[model samples]
Target: MNKKKLPLKVLKALEPFVGMQGELFTIEHPGNNLLLVKDKDPNSKFYYTIEKHQIRDGKDIYSVIFAPKNDKEVGAYSTTIGADDITTTFNSWVLFLENYSKVKSFFDDPILESYQAEFFSNFEFVDEHAETNPFQTAEILQLDYLLEHVSTRLIELSDENNREANEVIVAEIAFIRESLTNRSQKWVVEQISNIYAKIAKQGVPFIKEFWAEGKKELIKIGIKALIESAQNLIS
Candidate 1:
């Protein structure tokens, strides 16, 4: 069984901006910058670390954290950026938080409540454990049926307009489907994480591959169903 590592594309996108100094600049790949947006308590968590510095001008200087964990110990490395103006740093941070928040909210779909419930039901914790394993609680086998349904619907909807974004979305869905069918647990988690990371880093181009053929009747049905569900939920 092969395990899926994190998306190299996303990590590549993050590299240039990871510890860069800028003025009036935007950090495009803000999704992986988890420290600013996520909750800090033990119950909820996000990865990464932050170090603040007092610059010569008394402004806040920041660094990026790099860490990978194993069963035995937690280790970390930090990279410091050159310098950023006050306004650019603040704006960039806010934009990063907003983007990550949106990605997080999408995973909170009403459809996932039951899957999450099932996940936590069998979730285990060791009181003496020092390192946290984020991947252990997942049970994507439960997601297969729902994911296929959503994928088919999304593919149909994309057929209607043949839009690039919809196409890529369809490919992602297929990737998830194939992973599920093969019972590739690590691949499933990696794909989901990549989806969020893509949305955070590159936005919707994450789904451009599937929309190439242009609108189909199935897609129209899917689009209608999706809209109807949205309306009913809102109502």
Candidate 2:
């Protein structure tokens, strides 16, 4: 196994900036500059890695690799330069993350498909461990149902005039749903607060009333901590 690794200096420099994207993606670094953002579809799961360096000619070069399971499968590589300033680096990566999540598919291009065919000549697609998607937790079944109602209402309330806020609201709902599997009361509450803040206008009352009606079901069958989190979202 030829594992591609990044230098310790690069990893340390990238830590704080990389962490900012955590809330928006299922990120896994595993002690390197390589960042893995899990796709919702298991069969089409992919990763994006960015490496920053200033090793030659006193210029910063950002090298990006978009692939499946890093070097374990085929990849697309692009190198860019002069993104040395911190602000530039931050903006570049944030844009990359947003673009990646929106486009969601790179190998659809014939060029990228050719690259994959080349790599798979000797490489096998990594059999990444299967995970239960949509993240079901028995104890949070009622809370999950409540979140579904909330998500549906959010879509109904979505406005093209407030596209970015609508996007944030949608993403926050996803964070809230994924948090249910962790069984972490604190994390779920944090996500709830996040979603509530973004949707306070037009979105809050709907959630509040929904919670009012939904809490009865929660009280009957849901986890206590989740019940409290529901209260926190409205209060």
Candidate 3:
């Protein structure tokens, strides 16, 4: 198999994480762009692949798949990133790398290994059996948009020194980061609802000024749509 070269930008972004002990390889095939990180332990490996294809709108779609080496029979988790060009593609990969590093750390720490294994198994099961495309749903797409908008506004609020709101926003950011790996619809609904409820308690005026009235309603609609969609999937 011919080894594919990763873009210079991606290689640079991954440089800090590359230690003296492991091997990094990239491969480009007709269907996918691949990056494989093989740890010192031969049994352990990390796979990151991106496949570009066209959607109904004639827009390019980049789908990312990340799978950690596990002894169990588990499939990889996948997600889509909205990217129109190479720069945006690189930025999306960098964002993914940030979360991938956190998940990778779980395997490196002895104390977290068990929990990591459990997470992998659960993730595999969900990936194998999920009937609906989590990303394709109108509700999920809306929720993703709302969360991103809120995240940006929260950063602005934080910069202004709203410490309490910043704290909550930080936690929400962490939750959103973790969800990228798990991709659980019910979990996404719960986390979004949790943040919405907490912010709601701070008063409508505060929410309006910070997150905006239109965005707030969009979140509410997104959450309700997700909850109902999940229920329909169950029945």
Candidate 4:
């Protein structure tokens, strides 16, 4: 982290939501040379960061980053436009944070999706308990992390106004969690389908694309199976 004092305007821009006191979970002003804000629930290491770069033509060029899970999006960064001036960077970041859940692209991994589709499309569904797991150790581990994030995000993103929908989704996730801990997971895909259906109907768009209409391949790789099938894919 660089040590420097931000101009008064920049300071004023960040004054409103500077900590855990706002709509976004929490933010920390580690130093004036850069501003640091975290993604919701402080869950993922992927951060919404803005920092100054030492290249200036007419204005200071700052590199802005808002990559979730450290997987950068296609148009995820407009660093040159926003970060050239701290105030602009701050404002754009606030919008991204506030609307984080609504935006699906932030979490979409095109390369992974392509791989997931291509790899698993014709793949066999072996007994997940067998040692011959079809996923690499790292990919399998990521599934665990992805499961945790998905569970937390589902609860947080549930529609409070739609009490029934919210409660139903909550209950569904709880059951799914229980299945993960226990050995009985034959119904994992079914449960996820139920959750997906509710989300689609309500238009609460967090993980809908995650389990989108035609991504049956990913659905077949049941979360429960991911747990039992924990060996290298290439073995």
Instruction: State each model's C-alpha RMSD to the native.
Output: 16.6, 16.0, 16.1, 17.9
Best by TM-score: 2
TM-score of each: 0.25, 0.37, 0.32, 0.30
* Model 3, CA-based lDDT: 0.45
- lDDT per residue, candidate 1, 85-107, as tens digits? 33344444445434444565544
lDDT of 2 by residue, 56-147 (tens): 67645656545432223335545554434434544444455455546746554444333323322322212221122222355467667766
lDDT (0-100) at residue 169 of candidate 4? 65
Task: Look at candidate 2 and tell me the lDDT of residue 212.
Answer: 72
71-174: candidate 3 lDDT, tens digit per residue: 34334667675443434544344444444545644346443343323322322222432322244366555555666766666666664546676676657656
Worst 10 residues of 3 by lDDT: 20-29
Output the better candidate (1/2) by lDDT. Answer: 2
Preferred candidate (TM-score higher): 3 or 4: 3
lDDT score for candidate 2 against the true structure? 0.50
Considering lDDT, which of the candidate structures 3 and 4 is the better prediction for this target?
A: 4
lDDT of 4 by residue, 142-198 (tens): 434545555566667655576666665666566565544331222333344445445
Count backbone clashes in candidate 1: 17
Q: Among all windows of ten consecutive residues in candidate 1, which has the lowest summed lDDT?
A: 127-136
How many residue pairs clash in each candidate at the backbone level? 17, 0, 2, 2
